[model samples]
Target chain A: MKKQIIYSLKSPYRENLDVIGFTFGSGEKSACIVGSTRGNEVQQMYICSQVVHALKKLERQGEITEGRSIMVVPCINYYSMNIGKRFWTMDNTDINRMFPGYEFGETTQRIADGVFRQVQGFKFGIQLASFYQSGDFLPHVKMMKTEFSQPEKMLEFGLPYALTRKPRPYDTTTLNYNWQIWETQAFSVYSYGTETVDEKASQVSVDAILRFLSAEGIVRANVKPGYVSRIIEENTMQQVHTEHGGIFKTLVKIGDTVYEGQVLGEVYNPLDGEKICEVKADKCGTVFFIYNKPLIMQNSVAYKIVDF
Target chain B: MIQTVAENELSVNEKLKIRKNTYQNGKGKRISIVTGTHGDELEGQFAVWLVGDYIKKNIGCLNGTVDIYPALNPLGIDSITRGIPGFDLDMNRVFPGFSEGTMAECVCNAIVEDIKGSEVCVDIHASNIYLRELPQIRISRDTAESLVPLAKMMNIDFVWVHESATVLRSTLAHSLNSIGTKTLVVELGVGMRINKDLGYQLLNGIINLLYELGMWSEKPDFEVRQPIVSFDGAVGFVNSDASGVFVSDVEFGSEVEKGDVIGRVLNPLTAESEPVKAVCSGLLFTLREYPVVYGGSLIARILSREEEN
Candidate 1:
């Protein structure tokens, strides 16, 4: 195991910001994994750390296949993480949006350029990503709808679902889309948590990466096949919205299978405690996302269900 | 007239409001000046205030409508942060936003929709906190043919034409240009603190532009300079080779010859100094305001005249 300084920026007050990457085995550039572009992505960092731990053990046991290399960068925005902020501490710019970045541009853009220059050109790129919304997601591997994206390769992750999403205007600058544009097949693995760490979800994420490595022949080890992964398109998901502004109470959780017209959550008047409306499933599907916030505004998205 | 473009109710008494003030005559060509996209850059706010006040005091002489958005991200300015405090989003990077979106999106939507059809749009800005820059006008290269003449009339020291594609499409100027509103971006001073001289100079520039555009009958009282026009490739940036404290030898807006010593990087522990020099003869439009810099940080931006068009 070798610890490398992928990028560094000098600070006046505090210590210089250094982005560290861990590499195991040495030969062909096989795979690269990035975690926690934002400071609040604790779960993603936890999963990557676990992956690093497992890969170190596998290297000691000589299970890593010869002539293959793998690199793991557990956290990129450590300054923000130290302050409990989500973006770059100085400019509040998101490192994720500045991929293929400008070396002479803003501070965040320089960091992005420095890091991307080191990580680009790998055969496969995996990013431990999180959602923009404050909610839970079922552990899944997501791929952008690009020419380089192949849904068949996602089955190796052994996650329950593999989702293909069309890139939005903002997504074009994301690490996943940029990787695909540069001819490196990119996959974003979304775990169940963002701000907090869920041990079960982290383990599931770490295992999924290991399973993918073994399947790709990067590691010569036997890993459990956890789930019969299903492929789904992003546009097919049904979004459930709230009709009233009130306190939100949901009994159903993410990944729960529900029938049509089933009660999902209830919105109560914030002042009276009386129920304003009850949110229900519109189609027979699996609850892929449940809003975890305690209050819901009118027309806010409360749930997203993937019809089976 | 005062109008609320967007509002967010964080608490009962605490609310975030994006307000716009307008002065109008019967009707002619409409012009909109917007600033305060980033919270830390406060010079634009002061310039807008000065311009807005000038228009208010001279409302009867106005030929067309003038819309001024003094503070777009009030919450950010209140906290002295660059991006919006709660959302952690840059207001400048969410232009032409969706109507049904988050708080920052809604604010962008409101501003874009309000100023979409204006005849002239001016986006004001201050340099980042790390650097101090001269008062200048920046227009995208693609829109240079139509906007350069107006940019030159802004009474600023330099007019820069940069590649539009190199910038993010989400920027207000880029979005406005896409919709046929050729926007001129004015960047001056430094972040956090206002440079009163440049602020008033830019304010006069806006008044001069309004007069040039036939939006106002009265002309600016002050004399404007013959602005030097620069293309994207003509700007030279001096970068540090090592992380250290930078002490600049020249001031912002200083003219330099080829191979002039512009600054030096000093290592406190080693007591070593590396002198930074200019590559060509031109105006130094941007200089490092903050002394501490990383190895890759820009020390100075010299507007070279080798290939000026």
Candidate 2:
């Protein structure tokens, strides 16, 4: 196991920003795993760190297969993380959206360019990503519908779901899309939390990565295959929106299975504590997404369910 | 003529009103000048003030109408914030906005709708807080075909033609172009503060553009320098190797050849200095003004006329 500085930038006030990567084995560039691109994505960073810890142990025990290498970049945007910002602190720009960045562009673009250059050339890329909105998601691997998307191989992670998403306009600059454009099959592993680390989901994410490495013959570790991941299309999910803006009280957690028309949450008027509306499930399926913020705005997505 | 484009009630005592000033003599071509899209970029506000005064003094000489929408995001400027204060959203990002959407969206929608049918639109801006920039006119590919020639008539030093596909579609100029308005974005000075000289220079550029477009009967009184017309890819970025106080050796608009040291990143703690060298021969249009910079931060942007193969 070798700890390498994948990229570094000079800072004026504090220490230089360094993107650290952990490598296991010596030869082939088998897989590259990126943790959090945003500072608020603490869960993503924690999960990647756990993966690094496990890979280090596996490498020490000679479990990592010869001539197969894997790289784990725990955190890419540490400068933002230090200040608890979701994007670049200075310009308020998102580094995640500056994929295959211009070297001479803005700060975020340069960071993306430097980081992407290091993570490219791997056979597979996995990004422990989070949603833009504050929410809890059922742990799953998401793949963009690009030319290089390998949906079948993503099931090797053994997560509950392998979601395929169609790219949006803003998604064109994302690392996941650019990774695929560069012919590296990329997958975004979303856990249950972002700002706060969820232990169970983090463990699931670490285990899933180990399971994938083992299944692909990159590592010879005896990790258990977690689940038979179901292939899900992004459009198939049912979004539940709130009708009234008020204080939200969620009754069910993410991953909870619910029957059709079941009460998922209730909104109470802030002025008087009177129940404004009840958010209900319209489909019989597992809860895929749940809004974690205390306040629910009118017409805001409160939950998403994966049809059974 | 001054009229309100958008008005939103913030409180009983205060209301946010986006105003537009029009200068007209006879109907020919309508030109719209927009600024203050981002509250922090105040250089455009000064340019608008100067241009509004110019148009007012010479209103009788104007052959067509000139519409100037200055301070588009009043709520943002009121609090000295970049985005809309409560929404914390960049008004520039929600272009061609929805009429029935949120406050920022409605504001954007109103602005887009009003400026969509203009003969030409010039969106003015200042660099963000961190950098100092030389006055330049930026146009996308589709806009370049029709606006670059007019952009050359402006007094700015650089005219950058970027690929339209690569530019963000949500920007005001992008949305205006989508609706068939030939738009040119003029960015100058720095954010939060205004350079009087650059402000007057860009103001003159707008007047010169108006004169060339036949909106003004007389030639613009300001001197116009031939601008370096370059593609977006012709700009080169110089990044810092070490994290430290960036003490620039050269100022904005400094001309440097390849391998010249533009600045040095000095580590105040270690007292070590790392020199940042220029990779291409061009004029430095952007220089980092805020000294404290992180590794990978753009220290300078050099604009050259070299065509990318």
- Candidate 2 on B188-271: residue-level lDDT in tens? 888999889988888778778878888888886657878888887798878775666888887668788989999898877878
Docking class of 2: incorrect
- Judging by TM-score against the true structure, name the best candidate: 1
Model 1 chain B — which ten-residue stretch has the worst lDDT? B7-16
**Lowest summed lDDT over 10 consecutive residues: which window, candidate 1 chain A?**
A293-302
Q: Which ranges in model 1 have alpha carbons more than 4 Å from their true place?
A: A7-18, A83-85, A89-91, A102-110, A168-173, A233-251, A257-285, A291-302, B11-15
Best by DockQ: 1
lDDT values, one for every candidate: 0.84, 0.83
User: What tens-digit string does per-residue lDDT give for candidate 1 at B117-193?
Assistant: 99989999999898888888888778889998998888898898887653368888888888998799998989999
Question: Largest lDDT belongs to which candidate?
Answer: 1
Q: How much of the true contact map at the interface does candidate 1 reproduce, as a fraction? A: 0.10
lDDT of 1 at A109: 76
lDDT of 2 by residue, A1-308 (tens): 88989887765666678899898888999999999999888889999999988888888899989999899999999889999877787678888878998776667888899999989989889999887656788889999998768799889999999999988555788999999999898988988888898898899988888888888899876776688889999878988877667788999987899999999999987767889789999878999889887866665678889976
